[model samples]
Target: MTGFDTFLVADWSAAQGVRRAGKDAIWIALAQDGAVKPARHFSTRLDAEAWIAETIRAEIAAGRRVMAAFDFPFGYPTGVVEIICGAADPLALWDWLAARITDDARGRNNRFAVAEEINALFPGEGPFWGKHNRDAYPGIPYGGRSRTAEVSEKRACDISAKASSSVWQLAFPPTVGGQALMGMPMLSRLRRIQGCAVWPFEAWQEAQAVLTEIWPGLIEPAVRASDDLRDRAQVEGLARALSRLPLAELERMMDIDAPEEGWILGAGHGERLTDLARPNSLRPPPLRNDCFALPAGVDWTPVDTALALLRERLHPVTGTTKSGLFEAEGRILAEDVIARRANPPHPNTAVDGYGFAAASVGEGDAVLPLVQGRAAAGAPFEGPVPRGSALRVLTGADLPAGVDTVVLDEDCSVGDGRVAFRGGVKPGANTRKAGEDAGEGDRVLSAGRKLTAPDLALAAAVGHGTLPIREKLRVAVLSTGDELTEPGDVPGAGGIFDANRPMLLSTLARWGHVPVDLGRIPDDRSAVAAAFDRAGRDADVLLTSGGASAGDEDHVSALLREAGAMQEWRIALKPGRPLALGLWNDIPVFGLPGNPVAAFVCTLIFARPALTVLAGGNWAEPQGFEIPAAFEKRKKPGRREYLRARMRDGCAEVFPSEGSGRVSSLSWGEGLVEIEDGERHIRPGDPVRFIPYGSFGL
Candidate 1:
C-alpha cells in the first residue's frame, strides 16, 4: 500500500568543448506531491558525487527515503576492474584474495596487468572474478549483504518484470516499445552488484528497440548523445540481471521496509512509482442538464440546446438505503462491504462418501467395521470412529472426527462391517475448508460497486440481512412534436410514429432511474407549458424530444423561457444539433430534436452523462481512438462532426448514409468519427479520432 514519494533523477552530461571529459550532471528532483524542486548542476565527478551524498544524507535525515540514481558504473568488477558500484563493501573472500594478489608474491607476477587480465590469471580464485568469490567475501561491512543481499536481488528482479510488463501493455503503439527499451536501463541502474554486471549491453539494446517501438515520443526526446551512452549501458546491465532473478524473491526483498511501515523503500516498485507520480485517483465530474442556445440560421441547433437543457433538469432525487439480499437485485452500493464471517464457517465435506481416518485405510480391499454415524445438512458427527472403522456419509455431510479421506461410494464395496475401497484415497480429499470461499474481514464489495445477483448471494453468505445502496434518481420523460405518435397506434396525416420516447425510456431505466412517462405533447406553446408544469410537480427531471430549435413550431424553447430561468451556450459538436436546455419551476427540462435518430444520438452525447451525474456518479467527457479513415469527406468549418463509422480491417469506414436524421447509420455503426471544428476536409486513409459508444458505458 505504501507508494513512492519522489524521483531524484540525475542527467549527467559532458561540458561543451571538453575532451575526455567527465559528466556535467543534471540532478532533477521530482516530488510525488506535485512539486518540482530546483535542478542542481555539477561540473565535475567530485562535485556530482558530493552533491549526491549530501542530498541523500539530508533526505534520510528528513525522514524522506530517496532513490538516488547516477549515470556511472555501480557494479563490481567482474575482472580486476572496480566499477562505480554503491558504497557497499566487497565480499570477505574477495578482500582476502585481493590481499593475496597484491602481496609481494602474486603482485610481482601479474598485479600490474589490467584487472580483467589479472582476474583471468586467477579465475575463480581472484577477488573480482566469480560468484564463488562473492559468496566467500563479506559485502559492505556496515550494511552487510548477509542480511539483505538475497532480499535485494529478488526485489530488483521483480521490479524489473513489473516495469517491463506495464510498459509493454500500453495500447498505444509508441508507448509499448518505449517502455520495453527503458526496461533495460531501469534494471541496469538498480541492480549493479560489485562483482558482476548481471545486465549487459546486449540486453539493453534489445530493450531499447522495444521501448522505441512502443513510445517513440518519450525515447526520441530523451535519446540525446550526452545521456544515451550511459543510459544504454545501465539498461543492458539491469535487464540481463532481471531475466535471471526469481520474481517472487525480488518482491519479498522490496517489501522488507515500506513507507506504510515507516520504511523509506517499499515493494511492488511499479505501484509505488505510480503512487509517487500521481497520489490522487482520477475522478470525473457528474453530468449536468444545462442547455446551449443555437444561433439563427443553424440547422443543428437542437443537439446543443438539448444537452444544455438536460444538465439542469436532471437533479438527484431519492434517498439511499440498504435492502434485503433478495430485494437488492439492481441497486448500486452506497459503501464498501466486508464479510461478517468466513464462508463455509467450518471445515465440511464436499463429497458424498465415507469419512474415516486415512491412517486406518489399509492396502488391498481392506474391510473395517462400519459405524452408524450420520452427517446431514444441519447435523454433524459428535465422536471419532475407532481404528479399522468406516462411516456412512452423504453429500454435504460434515467430515466425522478422526477422518481425513473419503472414498466415493462408486469406488467402495459394502461388506459385513466395513466399506472396501477399490482405489487409493488421499487425506483431506473432498473436503470444503473453512474460509476457502471467503475469509473473515475480507472486503466483499468496494464502495460504489453496483450490486449484481452474485453480489447479493455473496452478501447473504456473509450473513448480511440488508445492503446499502445509493438513491435512485426520479426522471420524467416527455416526447414533443405533432408529427410524433406512439408505436402500434394509427398515425394521423403528417404524424410520424414516436421512437425517441421508447428509446429514451429504455436508456433511463438502464441508468438506475425511476422514469415517469409524461406522454406526448403537440408542438404548441400552451401544450409545452402544460407538460413542463406537470413534470415539475411530479419528477426531479423533465426530458423532452423535439421543439429545441428556434423554428416557430419549436415551442419548447419559448415555453421554457415563459416558465423558468434558463441559460444556453452553444457547444462545438456535430450530428444532433439545435439542442435546448432550461429550467421550469425549479425542474430542469431538456428539449431534444423531433427526428428519431437525432434525438437518440443527442441523448447519448448529452442525456446519459447528465443522468449519471443525477445518480451521484462522476461523468466525464468520453474518450475515443484516433484511427485511419477509410473514406474521404469534406465539411464546413467551425463545427465538430461525428460520423457513424465501422472499423473494417482496422480502418474506420464511414457509413454511406452520413446524416443525423439517419438513425440506422448509428445502429450499424461501430464508433463515431470526430472531426475537429475548423478541420473542413479529411482524405481517405487519413488518421481521424473516433469514440466508440461502448466507452461511454452506453
Candidate 2:
C-alpha cells in the first residue's frame, strides 16, 4: 500500500553558473495526494544543500517517513570509486568529492581543474574528460570516448538506456561527465550530513531517511523548453511515481548487487515503468484468474497494456430488468424478444393489383370484371373469386380466398370497375407469405446487444411493448483540494480553477451516462471519505481529481489510506502521471491529478475506455492518424509522450511547452502526437503518430 511518509524529488544541475531560475541550479517539488505541489527553485548549490537538509529534518523530526531522490549518478564504474577515493566503497567517492571540487555561489567553479586532478590519479587521463575552454585540465579528450568506463564496465542499465551518454564521455549534452564533476560534489556533501542512508552502499530500512540516485531518462517525459520548468517537472513527476510504487518493486530497485555502480532509483523499474507509459485503465474489469495480483512498484502501465488487462477483468453488470421498447435505445438487451405472432399473420399482397388463380387466367389479353368488394390494407374480401373473375387488392392487404396470383393493374385498362389483364399470371406474385419475415416465437433480438433505433422498431414489430435490458451506469464526479476554486471564479493566491471535475462530468454525460456533480472539496480527509461513502450508495463509479499526492496537504490520498481502497497511481504516459484507481464502498473510483491538461489526457486515455465497458459497450482502441512533425524535436528513451499538437499544413505542430497546467494548450492542440520509446531525432518531416482531441470525444 504505502511506501514513504514524505516524498521529495530534486532535479540536479551540473552546469556552472550563478543560478537564479534555470536548469543549471536545483529545482525541487513535493509529491502530495496523488499530485505534485508547486515547484521550488534553488538558485545556488549552497542554497539547495541547506534547504534539503532543513526539509529532511523538518519532516523526519515530525515523525513522518521520508524518501528523497536526487537526479545524478551516485557511483562510478567498478574500481574507479576505490582508486580515486583510496577504497572501493561507493560512499568513499562521495566523501572524497565532498572534500574536493570547490564550487561557490558565484558562477566560478574549478570543474575543469578538478577533472585534471582526478585524471592525474589514473595512469593516463582516464574515466573522465571533455574539458571547457578555460579549463586547465590536460589529457582530456575533446569529442568522444577514447575508452570505456572504469574496469572496462557498463552499468547493467546502460544496455537499455540509449539516451544516457556513457559517463566516460564526461561533458556536453547527454553525457554525464560534466554532471558527474558537479553532481558528485553535491552528493559528497550529503555524505557529511548526519542520518542519511545512501542507497546500495547502505542497507535501506523504512525507518532511516533515504537518499537514492535518479535518472530522468529512466522515466522520460517530453522535453520542456524552459530549463527550470523542465527540471522541476521531472522531479515532481518522479516523486509522484515513487509514492505509489509497490514495496516489492522498491525492494528490487534497492537490491542492486553492484555497490561500485550504484543503481538508479528506478533503473530496474523500466520494464514496468514502460507500462506506466501505458494509458490508465478505464473501468478496468476485475481479474479473471488468480493471476490478478498486479506487479508491485509499477506506477505506469502503458495505455494499450492497461486496456487489455483491465478490459479482460471486466465483471460486466449481470442483473437485468424490463424497459419499454420506445426508451431502449442505449440499453443492452438481457433476453431475446420473441415474435408473439407471425409478421403480417397471413399471406398479403405486396402491391395494389388484380388477384386471381394463375390457372384461372388466360394467356392472351382478357378483360375481367372487378369484384363487388375490394381488399385494402386494413380490409379483406370475404369470398373466393369465380373461376373466370378477379379481385382488386391493395398493398399489404390479405389475398381474397382462392386467389393465388395477381395481375398488374397498370398493365391493364380498368373500365366500369373492371380490370384488363394478360393471360400470364404468376402464382404468389406481389404477395408476402405468412411468417415470411419472422416466424411465430422467433427471437427478434438476442441478449447482450445494445438497443438501437432499429432494434426498438423490431421489438415493436414483434408486438413487444417492453424488452429486457441491463441498467444504465451512473457516475459521480468529485474534485478535491484546498487550492481549487470553481471554474469561472477568480482564483485567489495559489488557487486554481477546478477544471477537472466539470470536464469529467461533461465527458461522462457525452458518453450517455449520468454524471452527478459532487463539486469541489477542500483538502480534508474526513470530507473526502464521507463524500465517497455517501455517493457510492447511488453511483456505479466515482471520478475524482486533486489532493491525490502524498504531500502533507493531500487529504484525498490520506483518506484513501484511512478508509477507501486504492488500486493504482502514476503512469508513464505524458501529460498525466498521477492517476489512481480504487474502490470506495464497492463503487469504482478513479483519481486523476490536479493539473487540468493532465486530468484531461488521463480522462480520454483511461476513463473513456473504462466507462464505455461499464456502459455496456465494447472496448475499442483509440483511433489515430499519421502526420509529419512540423518542427524539430528530440526525446530520450524509456517512456511514451502525448505531445499537445495541432494539424497545420498537413503536419503536426506541437505546443512548445509540455506543462500540463497550461489550459490554453488543451484548446490549442487538436490532439496528441504519441511518441514511442527510445531516442528520437524528429525533424520537420518525420512521420509522427497523432490522435486528435475529437477522437477522445472532447
Per-model C-alpha lDDT, please? 0.52, 0.70
lDDT of 1 by residue, 222-275 (tens): 132123343332222222222212222223433432111011122233321211
Provide the lowest-lDDT 10-residue window in model 2: 274-283
Residues 672-693 of candidate 2 have per-residue lDDT tens digits of 9989866788999999999987
Tell me the RMSD of model 1 versus the true structure.
Answer: 26.1
Q: How well does candidate 1 score on lDDT at residue 231? A: 38
What residue runs in model 2 are displaced by over 4 Å at the alpha carbon? 1-300, 317-319, 356-369, 383-389, 400-412, 421-430, 433-437, 561-564, 569-572, 615-659, 665-698
> Global lDDT for candidate 1?
0.52
For model 1, the superposed segments whose C-alpha errors exceed 4 Å read 1-316, 321-324, 334-340, 356-370, 385-392, 400-416, 419-427, 446-450, 465-472, 482-497, 509-512, 523-526, 549-569, 578-586, 616-655, 666-698
Alpha-carbon RMSD to native, per candidate: 26.1, 28.7
